[model samples]
Target: MLLCLDIGNTNIKAGIFEGEELIAHWRFSTQRHRLADEYAALFLNLFALNGIRLRDIRGCAVACVVPPLRVVFEEMIQRYLGVNPLIVGPGIKTGIRLAVENPREVGADRVANAVATFRRYGGPAIAIAFGTATVFDVISREGEYLGGAIAPGIIVAAEALVTAAAQLYQVELIRPPRAIGRNTIQAMQSGLILGFASMVEGMIQRLQAELEEPARVIATGGLADTIAQEVRSIQVVDPHLTLHGLRFLYELNRRR
Candidate 1:
């Protein structure tokens, strides 16, 4: 089985793949302070619950944005699975041309998401990833990773609002009946959820206007489905896009 891990800023996602089919997957908080043994124990418990064995893992791949956790996970994988993980970064064959000023500056998770999205739905395309930061990765008609914009994610923005305003409390990020809310909590929720959706739609529209060709907008990340549910502009939402990209990247690099 192929073991893939996507360590984002807020969450760590792990997937066990039996060939091309994902057999089991789990998500946990991204504990940057966790030790290698602690991470191993967490993985062991997850595997045990699903009737999977550490010895059954054939290979591993990782897409991590948290630099501190990279070595920790790598050490854990090596000790537990007896295989060094293929880390996604510069020099990785993602099958996409990065047009950014410094391609290395791009997050591995974002790169993986863009590569997978473009491959699945060829460019010109725009990928709105709802993560720690809501990222907009754009691909040109020629299939180049033309960097896009970034904004505070829904959760981050909400947290900021709550922290900055003493009167405001953290509310569930959900869409209300109307754009104008009736109460303070509803208003905050509406502003964060619908407002974020509007921000995405506006950015995408502006992006489309700037491009001569039309771009297909796709959404991914943990909060994708929830946000996309309310936003009409988002065309597709693939929660496991990063893992699929990691799998694709693994295959690409394995042959090389």
Candidate 2:
């Protein structure tokens, strides 16, 4: 079994794969202050609940956006799993040509998404990850990682509005009964959810124009399904895209 970790700014998503099949997965809040032993304990408890033993995990792959947690997880994997994790960063064999200005500036999560998207769906394809910051990564028909766009995530935008405005408080991020909201909560939801849907559609159109052809739109992340239902442009939603990408990357660079 391979342990795949997708550590983002908001959450840490872990998956245990038996070969290519993901047997079990879990999500936890990202805590930067947590020690290696604490993480090890948490993983051990999860493994026990899932009927997976620590010794069964043969390899580990990590796609971490949180810099502080990288060393924490690396240490935990080395100390507890007894295997050095394949961290997604420089020197990793991603099997995609990065056409961006500075490839190093690209987030590891984005790379993972691109790798998985292109491999699974092929290109031209656009992968939108609605995480801490909503990111759109474009892959060409020839498997080139053409950089896309980034915008403030729906939750982030809603939180910012609540923080800046004195009267407005946070509301549930759901689509209102109608676009013309009846009340304050409805208005906020309309703006946050429906408005985001419109933004996604428009961005997809713009990106497709730049690509000079129509591309398959893939959405992932916690809010992906919610927003994807509202937008017609998003064709696929696979929440575990990053985990699969980690597995793919691990296979690409595994010691022979």
Candidate 3:
């Protein structure tokens, strides 16, 4: 089995794949200061619960946005699993043409999403990742990685609003009963939820217009489900897009 880990700003996602089939997956809060042993122990317990042994893990790969956790994961895999996991970074073989001004600045998760999107949907696609920051990554018709926009994510933006305003409090991320709200809390929720969905649809519309062809829109991330539920433009929501991307890159480079 191949172990795939995706460390985002908010969460650490781990998946155990038996060949190409993902057999077990788990999510944990991202604790940057956690010790390597702690991380290893956590994985060990998870594996035990799933009837997996450490010896069964033959290979591993990771796609991480949190830089501090990189070494942590490297050590965990090396010490516990006895295999060096492929860490996605500058030298990784993604096979996707990146058109960013400074390609190195792009996050590994973003790159992985691009690779997976192209692999699944072919070319001229846009993947909107609803994570710490909502990101829109564009893939050209020729499979080039054209960079897209980044905005504060729905939850982050909502939290900021709640923090800045003295009276407003945090509300559920669900959409308001109607676009026009009857009460204060409902109105605030409606504005943030439906308003954000509208913003996503509007951006996708503009992106499709500017691209070489009508791009297929896909959403991936923790908040993807909430926004995608209301938005009609998002065609697919593959939460494991980045993990699959890492697996693809691992196969590409491991053979070489």
Worst 10 residues of 2 by lDDT: 247-256
Task: For residues 86-182, write the lDDT of model 2, one tens digit per residue.
Answer: 9999878899999989999989999999999999999999999998898999999999999999999988899999999999998988779999989
**Residues 70-138 of candidate 1: C-alpha lDDT, one tens digit per residue:** 999999999888998999998878888999899999999888888888878888998998989999989
Which ranges in model 1 have alpha carbons more than 4 Å from their true place?
none
What is the C-alpha local distance difference test score of each model?
Answer: 0.88, 0.94, 0.89
Error of 2 at 59 (Å): 0.3
Runs in model 2 lying further than 4 Å from the true structure: none
User: Higher-TM-score candidate among 2 and 3?
Assistant: 2
User: Cα deviation in Å at residue 18, candidate 1?
Assistant: 1.6
Sorted on TM-score, best first, the list reads 2, 3, 1
lDDT (10s digit) by residue, model 3, range 1-256: 8999999998888888888888988888999999899998898899999999999999998988988889999998999999988988898788888898999999888998999999888889999999889999999988899999999888889899999999989898887889888987898889888998999999998898889478889999888988999999999999888878878888888997
Instruction: Estimate the overall C-alpha local distance difference test score of candidate 2.
Output: 0.94
